[model samples]
Target: MKSILITTTALVGFAATAGAQEVNVVSWGGAYEKSQVEAYNKPFTEETGITVNMIAADNPATPLKAQVEANNVTGDVFDIEVSDAIRMCDEGALVEIDPADLPAAPDGTAAADDFIDGALQDCAVANIFWGTVIAYDTTKFEGQAPSTAADFFDLETYPGKRGLPKNPKRTLYLALIADGASPDEIYDLLGSDEGVQRAFDKLDTIKSDVVWWEAGAQPPQLLADGEVTMATGYNGRFFDAMVGEGKPFEIIWDGQYMDMDMFVIPKDAPNPEAAMEYLKFATDTQRLADQAKYIAYGPARQSSASLVGMYQDGKTEMAPHMPTNPDHLETAVMDDPEFWADHDAELSERFNAWLASS
Candidate 1:
């Protein structure tokens, strides 16, 4: 009887070990992914005994679309732009998520109420509000530094290659901003033929001096290499390069393009249960706020705002560096995911044609 009992206990232990899971998450690489690993993945595994596998992509949505089309869904969760989330959800490639299923705030506020507007969706939940803003090398300008959007395009004074992303989503908005358009009317203007042409016309001014960047990590590297003096890049990446690595860089918050990154599970994910569990764990108020310690992006949860504090260095405060800060938002262009979902392909074509033209 003693031997039989021991055998049974050993079998149960083996079964428990076999039940352990590893969730695969696709995300943008660099310091942003590091934040998730520290604040979400590590603690989640310690508490739940589930491992997390992070996969990097230029944009997670690209791999997600390929996996869905190929019918071999490997990644469990994808960290994608809100526009990509909206577009993918519309195509029925993503699973529907209920806000009620998410954990409520510590104060008993509902998740739906706690999250900022546009943070929750039927198929996605936002994690951070980041920005595409201007970053210039402080040592580049001796007397007067570039302070605004117009300064980015003034080649005569700045006199260095400008790093602009190779996408219309990021470039077009800046062109409009530099051309003296109001941030509130960016989307509306882009919707018209004249406005689209005007944006391209502004681009024509500095096309000869533009050094195009395709990845989030490239802008900083371009600036560091002296390939570009002023560049448009993710605020978090620039923050990491500046504060974390002690790069001689400074961010010009003028005309930032703000957008949220949402976490979504595909319908046929390899580990649906684990994916959902990780998603719920990672987007809670505390986790969202904790991420602020590593990156300057704002937490998506309203309750998380008060919880945010000093940076990971334990010295620098994270608030003023955040893209959502009031001073930074004065000229910020808020991303319209719905508008991008509808117009991305069309505008991308035009942008490509202009880039290819003389």
Candidate 2:
């Protein structure tokens, strides 16, 4: 009888601790993080009493990879790009997620069927669809504003410092677009040495005037500080700076690279159960749609589209600002996760070497 009482007491204590557990989530910072905090994290904490701790990353994939490799996983959940999610899953770094465990849509459709095609994988569940596009300071361009991808590389025409990310995945595509490679031909051309050489050559044209940025927040800061007249950055970040902060910025949607952001749990997450619980709660139709209130990125779920309306400011319509808006899709570049999953290593090495030279 004494042993049974002690065992019951221990079980009750464990339940109390579990109810108060915290899950660490790593995601891209700036407006994106703020959106998640408002839309997902706070509500989740209120409902479950599980505290959600956010950690920002330039790209969450970088730190996720490091943590998995070192066998020291600290974060419970990570928001990463589709390509990175695939790569990490293949490497056995992520925990497999079953679609059946996810919440069903309001119409009673199963999660696997309700989610958009390619939104769900064995190891990740997509939350949002975002893009990288060129944004320029409106105050700097008095006469004519830059509109197309070609204009981004036309140094003499819109002469001033240009801001670009310090990574190949984002930079190379823009270079190819400016070099006249159609969206359909970008991957094919990038498949060859000469094609890559062409991209590098194009980038070299404005190398001296480039201001490289690593984090999403840096581009808007660069433009605001007058360090660069224009920059290539996440469209959502630019939207936040323009609408939320009232920065004089205009996004050029031509040749924007669209990608999905997904949530993945590392293999040895500190709080695996809470991570899974948070992942499902955060990616639901309502939560995904609510995110649009704080940022311009589109929700990955089809049902979530109708729910997305105005921004937090209440008056500004968010449809025109979204990366997936019909008007912005004309020359959009869909991210090829399979290609990047296959060739990222080789291309990254070559890109790093090129960055070192001249």
Q: List the global CA lDDT of all models.
A: 0.91, 0.89
What stretches of model 1 exceed 4 Å from their correct place? 1-18
**Which candidate wins on TM-score?**
1
Q: Which lDDT tens digits does candidate 1 get at residues 1-358?
A: 3433443354345336647888999999999999999999987777667789999999899999999999999999999999999989999999999998887777778899999999999899999999999999988888988999999989988889999999999999899999999999999899999999889989999999999988799998998899989999999999999999999999999999999999999998988888887898899878899999999999999989999999999999999999989989899999999999999999999899888988
> All candidates' TM-scores?
0.95, 0.94
TM-score of 1: 0.95
User: Candidate 2 — which residues are off by over 4 angstroms?
Assistant: 1-17
Model 1: residue 246 alpha-carbon error in angstroms: 0.5
Q: TM-score for model 2?
A: 0.94
How many clashes (backbone atoms < 3 Å, residues ≥3 apart in a chain or on different chains) does model 2 have?
A: 0
lDDT of 2 by residue, 1-358 (tens): 3433443354345446677799999998778999999999997776667889999988899899898888899999999999999988998899999998887777767789989899999999999999999999999887988999899998888989999998888889889999889998989988999989999999999999999999889999999999999999999989888998899999999999999999999998999988887898898888899999999999988888999999999999999988889999988889999999998999999988988988
> What lDDT is reached at residue 297 by model 2?
93
